[model samples]
Target: MNDMEEDGRRTTMTTTKTRGIRLAKEENEKTDVRKYIPPLDGQYVEKWLNDSQNPGQVGEELVKQQFLLDLLHSKISARYERGLETAEIDEHAWQVQNSITAIKRRLKQLVDTVPPVVSLETTDSRCIEMYEEKQLMATQGMLRADILEERQRVARLCWQLHNTGEDTKEMVNEDPKNDEQEWVERCKLEEAARSALLEEINRLRSTCADLRARLEMEALSNEVPKYDSL
Candidate 1:
């Protein structure tokens, strides 16, 4: 009974080993079939077709060559069709890409050419204010000149009156105190007007300086680089 059991176990092990060896051999044979088959080539086909040494096998050779030629022609035709389709798809994709690029370029150009709406509005308003300030300054200058001319004229008139004949000098001396008081008051008023004008001019100069600083800041902000797309 012990010998029978050992023989049975040996038989089972041998059968499994043999089955595995058989399967491995079959797999190797399949691999060799794929590895040994020559790749199709037009030169090889032509050479085979041109051989005429075997007269008895001419008909079989001709049939085999014709089948190979048909298969090669079909493959070439299929490849050519696929190439044409791929080229068309590539061309369409290229055109789409170009259009997108052109659109982005145009948008960038517009962004560069067209100033910001808020900036434009602000610039126009500031320009108008500057013009008004210039006009005011001009008016102030004219008024200052006029006041100086009037003061000079009054001084000339006073000098001429003081240098008049004896009868005119005596008449002027009759109310000299009142005339002196009035002249002092007139000079004070003229000085006050000139001071006020100077103060206004200084204020306007400060305002212009502030405006210039703001404009420079805005220009610097605008100079920053902009992206073509997000």
Candidate 2:
């Protein structure tokens, strides 16, 4: 009876060890199957790859991870390039603003230093001196033309008077003293008109010349420096 009891205990011990070994082998197989069965998080990557023939391929996960990494790197690189470009533009804008400010200051100084061309009596008169000089020359020209025309008329009249005097002396018994006095008076009138015309012409010409010289001086004074850019 003792030997039979010992045999039964031994049999029970051997059965328990065999069952534990089988359970451990099944659990390991289940864990390995879980690796092939991708988690929900990786579903999108699987669908994108769409390799239906080998859905459980080991390299699919590695390929998806690499693709995500490359996309992220590209985005980062683009952002960095954009930031650099923006910085350059901002720097250039700041320089432009500074240049504009400096130019404005210089322009103000120019305005203050240069006298205005116009005055109370002369609207648009910055070039008034030049305008007046031109006017004077024009007037002088008109006066000179008039003087020439008058001199021609006076010469014609004098020729007519000489012809009349010679005809009188030949055709009629004339009083010599009376004839001589009339001739002298006629000659004096002609000389006086000629002298007056000549003097007026000379005065106009002189005034015109002086005005032209003054206009040139005023022009030099009015000239101011001009800016093309910065």
Candidate 3:
């Protein structure tokens, strides 16, 4: 009776161990299968391509796809070099290659569908010249308008300062100069204010001149055609 009990306990332990090992193995296989699945699918690629509007968008997509292809190629190369090629790696590589091929084909189709650009030489020279002249005139007119507006602002500032000086003078005349020292101080303050205003006006005038010179230079540069080597 004691021997039979010990044998039964041993059998139960063995069965439990086998079951645990089998469960672990199956879990690992499922993980491997998930790992081999392609990150992107045909539907995703088709949607991406369709959403792209211009060559720039397609170019960006191609860059991302190329990066993935290089990564997959590297993985496959590393596996083969290390004698570790497996069905999983091969399947992943195949799926990635298919994606890459599809991307390239769509890009080619986009390129083919785009219309050829009209050459500048094909356009009428007279029309081009007129267009350039119109652009130049427009820029010059803007500059002139800006300069006139700035001049008007300066004029208004000057008028305001002049009126303030006149008011100060009137106040000084209206108030009796009982204190000579105070009168002298008042005059000194007025002189200082006037000098500061004049300095500011000078600075503004210098800035205006500099801006005008720059605008003229820009206009000249635009007028001169930059010839390219034939």
Candidate 4:
């Protein structure tokens, strides 16, 4: 009985070893099918799918690979399109930034070359003084013109008075009843009026000359550079 029991135990061990070997061989075959089948050939999916009833793990792998390919074709393609759009936006932004830089440079050049126009809002007291001086000069010019016109009228009146005096003298010589003293008084008054007109004309001429000189000086000063050049 001891020998029979020992033989039985040996038989069970042999069967267990045989079963384990068979399972290990089957596992190695499945691993070889997954690893050695060239995925790059693009035919593994077709072969695995041809035998659907017995496809096993390889079939499930083909299904998962097909799903991944579809996802890449749909989602990744959309991602590529979005990347292209993003690149275009970045390029446009770069161009806009360059344009803005160019505009700023052009504005700086303009500012350097041209002076700003002065207005009533200018803070410079010189500008105010120059404006007031110009107004004064205009007024002086008008006054000078009026004075010249008046001088011309006065000279014409003086000539007429001299001619009338000569005519009255001839009439007085022809008529002895004419008052000689009254004629002399009228002649004296005419001379005084002529003298006054001559003095006024001379005074106006002096004032005009002075005003013209002052105007010239003011214009020269105005044309002078206000600030030092860089």
Candidate that would win on TM-score: 3
Please report how far candidate 3 places residue 187 from its true position, in Å: 99
How well is each residue in 12-85 modelled by candidate 1, as lDDT tens digits? 99999999999999999887453333322333433443443443343443344345434543454455445333
Predicted candidate 2 versus true structure: per-residue lDDT over 71-107, tens digit per residue: 5434544544454333443444344334333433444
Please say which candidate is ahead in TM-score: 3 or 4.
3
Candidate 3 lDDT over 62-159, as tens digits, reads 66665675676567556644556456865765676666667767776777676645444643463455455445444444554554565576679779
Q: What's every prediction's RMSD, in angstroms?
A: 37.5, 42.0, 24.7, 43.7
lDDT of each: 0.55, 0.56, 0.64, 0.56
Model 4: weakest 10-residue lDDT segment is 37-46
* Superposed Cα deviation of residue 180, candidate 2 (Å): 0.6
Measured against the true structure, the TM-scores of the candidates, in listed sequence, are 0.24, 0.28, 0.31, 0.26
What are the per-residue Cα lDDT tens digits for candidate 4 across 58-169? 4444444444444433453354444333344344434433433343344434444657554434535655565565555455455546655765676798899799878876
lDDT of 4: 0.56
Off by over 4 Å in 2: 1-126, 189-230
Clashing pairs in 2: 117-126
Ranking by lDDT: 3, 2, 4, 1
Model 2 TM-score is 0.28
